[model samples]
Target: MQYKSQAVAKPYFIAAIGLFVGQILFGLILGAQYVLGDFLFPAIPFNVARMVHTNLLIVWLLFGFMGGAYFMIPEEAETELFSPKLALLMFWIFLVAGAATIVGYLAVPYATLAELTGNDLLETMGREFLEQPLPTKIGIVVVALVFLFNITMTVLKGKKTAIATVLLIGLWGLAVFFLFSFYNPVNVVLDKFFWWWTVHLWVEGVWELILGSFLAFVLIKTTGVDREVIEKWLYVIVTLTLITGLIGMGHHYFWIGTPEYWQWWGSIFSALEPIPFFAMTVFAFNMVNRRRREHPNRAAVLWALGVGVMAFLGAGVWGFLHTLAPVNYYTHGSQITAAHGHMSFYGAYAMLVMMMISYAMPILNGKAANSNKSQVVEMWAFWLMTIAMVFITLFLTAAGILQVWLQRVSDSPLPFMVVQEKIAIFYWAREISGVFFLIGLILYITSFFIGGDKKETA
Candidate 1:
């Protein structure tokens, strides 16, 4: 809101929230399908729904990240965006490409969609998360390149700050790592080995840098903390993130036909992965305690704090739970993985984006903070969605524990389906939790429309 070009981020944020709603709705469908195998049946099979759910998550988060960058970069650099027009152009292009891809997923069969989109040319289809068609993949690269160019140029044209520098690194790394998706080697082991370059390295690696930058930016604004102190903390957090996360990639390599040495390396490094997150928790609270001013965007402040605690719990604690080779051997690809994934993603990236929106949206709409009435609603949405996710993770963790016991650790191992039947109760509980998440999402969307007297942070 400080720069005219920053107005462009409003659309990105709006579109992000829109797509987020779609993601959760599909998530509900997926959850129900788990409990009722024939819930959607031929119309929308579980696999298709699952793909939509996960893909939507990636796309929406990308939108949120882009929006956050557009909003924050200019202020950090003390300049307007290099090309607001180009930013808006790429926004439409990315949105269309994302929509078309989702339509293809829902309308045609996966194989048919792949064939139509020229999967035979490069054959990057059907990977777990990298399932976008060739053209969509290409479109992504184009959009990302253009977006990065704009932001980089903007930073170059103005004052450079630590927050902007780290953010750019994270964003550029995101683009660079995504190129691996196009590699798609024929060797299964090699393919998976490189696939983690895109998948695991993203959430656990570069994305953490992006998360830290945003956290620092918000803390500076909301807490009125000294930039020097926050930047120092940012440096420490980033260093820890890279040291821990880069080596932590070995955790995924453990079962991926990698070497035996990975067992010790992965165990040691992944165990230390929680240190950075712990630092983030301390950093958030410490800044708040030393705050020079209380921003009227109390909702945004609450979100900032939530990100620290939840990220520590989800990514730090739960991740360390099954991260070790011995524990992962039993829990790999189990519901426990799902549990960890759900919480870590929501607690870290998702909440970070939401915090950005909560902070920026009010400013974009011409206010220092939302009216107290609206902030109350937004805060309620936050807790409801967050707590709902916690329950979902807990229930899934319960299911995963039972599953590992019955299928792997038991004296008489049961078949997968039998184990699933035994765990159906937990699935039911998770599905119900998904409903609450949806309700919370609805409330979150509703917060945007609720307006009253504007409150000034000053």
Candidate 2:
């Protein structure tokens, strides 16, 4: 709200929350399907619902990153956005395209969607997370370019802070890495190898840069920490992130028909991958402990702290659990991967985005911070969602261990479907936990509309 143009971020943030709601609903559907296979068998199959769930997650987080940049950059630069109109235009364009593409996935069969969207020419449809049709993929590149242009030009015309510079580099890397998704060679090995260049590199690589930058920006505002100190921590975090994560890509190569060397290389590097998250946890708590003054936004401060703890436990701890080659050989593609995917993404990216919303939404909505009641509710939502995710990961991890034991490790190995039958109890438990997650999401969306007394920070 420092500049009128900053208001543009409002819609982007709102859209992100809306999509997050959609993502959770589909997630519940997926969970139910895990236990009750025929719940929506043909009408909305597991794969369809899953695509909707995951694609929404990616799209919404992208919205969060973009909105965060739009809001923070102008303030850091000490000027308005360079092209507010372009930013707005890109918002609607990206939103509409994303919505249409998701609807296309759910409305029609995926193969039909691909055929209609001209994936026959590019053949980028069958990949794991890059399942967006060719047209959608092209649109993604276009939108990213425009977004980079607007933010880059604004930063150039205004101030150039370390945080802003690092953010731009991360965004640029995101766009560049995504290009690898288009390189769908015939060899399945090559396909998966390069695909991780986008998937792993984004989450584990450049996205960490964005995460650190945002964390620094929020800590500076809330903790009254010296800018120099926070930015220095930011740089250190990103450096460790790349040093560990870039090489951590080898872990994926272990099972992908790659050389045996990856097993050693991946195990060694990925084991150290949690260092940055641990550092992040320390950095966050240290900043709060040394705060010069308390900001009025106690809920925002709470979120900042929660991001540190949860990101470490979910991404760092859980990741290290199965990251070793020996354990992963049995656990790969099991419920363990699913567990890691759920918590790690939620802990690192999803919660980070929500933290930004919790911090910025009140200011954007014309209050220094939310009413104590509203903040209290928001905090409740945070705990509910976060705790629910933890149980879900726990349940999935249980299912995965049982599965690996029964099907892979045990002498009397059972068939995959037979093992699944044994694990039905865990699936049921996961479905039950997912219900709470959905409820938490509902509360999260509802907290925004509540009104109460606005109090200033210390």
TM-scores for candidates 1 onward, in order: 0.98, 0.98
Model 2 ranges with Cα > 4 A deviation: 452-458
RMSD of 2: 2.3
Off by over 4 Å in 1: 453-458
Global lDDT of each candidate: 0.94, 0.90
RMSD for each of the candidates: 2.1, 2.3
lDDT of 1 at 229: 99
Tens-digit lDDT string for candidate 1 (299-355): 999999999999999999999999999999999999999999999999998999999
Q: Per-residue lDDT tens digits of candidate 2, residues 261-284?
A: 999999999999899999999999
- The 10-residue segment of model 1 with minimum total lDDT is 449-458
The CA lDDT at 18 in model 2 is: 88
